[model samples]
Target: MDIGILLLGVAVLIGAVVVSATGGDRKIARLDRRLARVEQKLDAIAANLGVDLPEPELATVKALLAEGKKIQAVRAYREATGADLKEAADAVERLGG
Candidate 1:
């Protein structure tokens, strides 16, 4: 009976941990969506105002591109801009890197 109680307690603890983790993940996803929306709005406002958003100056990315290391340039761009794989690749290509 004691072992059975211990097992039940362990199961409850594990279940609680899983629930907490899932909730945290949902919150993070929601925040990411909100941030993306805000970024888009800001970009639109800047465009309407004829303001060209300054590009991030990443020396490492530029250096890698200059060295003909396209893959490394993409990686560096992603690190610097927090961009995903496709975005980084496109940005690098646009830069003639």
Candidate 2:
């Protein structure tokens, strides 16, 4: 009888582990999809702008934009490219900035 109970407990533990793993996988998948979408948008923004932004610059600009740092974005663009303010703004506007 104890042997049967032990087997049943092991089965239940295995089932619970499987269920938990499946749930974790689902959450990871959703996070991956969300990340993919954000990456696509970033790519689109980069493409729309004529400038070829490096990965670091792109990431920084994304963070700046998220923080509502429009002026900072323009300034950073100018500083990075040594472009004038007008040119920087133009590039940003082209990118839907």
Candidate 3:
């Protein structure tokens, strides 16, 4: 009887620990997602402030490169996104690739 009681106690302890860890993990995940949304909003605000930030969508670059307007595409990317030449070229390559 004593051994059974002890086993039960240990099982309960382990279950509590597992629950606590899971709860903490869920909380962290929620906070991370919340922060991401806030960051996206801040990026939009920065773009509105004339920062010329890059858009998240790559369809425009892909289409431009596919049309063989490489130079115009690169220039448009640089002007609209304010990316350096190397960065703009890399992005274009990746988009087209």
Clashing pairs in model 3, backbone N/Cα/C closer than 3 A = none
The C-alpha TM-scores of every prediction are 0.63, 0.51, 0.52
lDDT (tens digit, per residue) of candidate 2 on 6-32:
999999999999999999999999999
Computed on alpha carbons, the lDDT of every model, listed in order, comes to 0.94, 0.80, 0.83
> What does candidate 1's lDDT look like per residue over 1-97, in tens digits?
9999999999999999999999999999999999999999999999999999677878998899899999999999999899999999999999887
- Identify the leading candidate in terms of TM-score: 1
- For residue 97, model 3's alpha carbon misses the true position, in angstroms, by 26
Better of 1 and 3 by TM-score: 1
Candidate topping lDDT? 1
**Winner of 2 and 3 under TM-score:** 3
After superposition on all CA atoms, how large is the RMSD of candidate 1?
Answer: 5.2
Candidate 2 steric clashes = 0
Candidate 2 Cα misplacement greater than 4 A, ranges: 54-97
Best-to-worst order by lDDT is 1, 3, 2
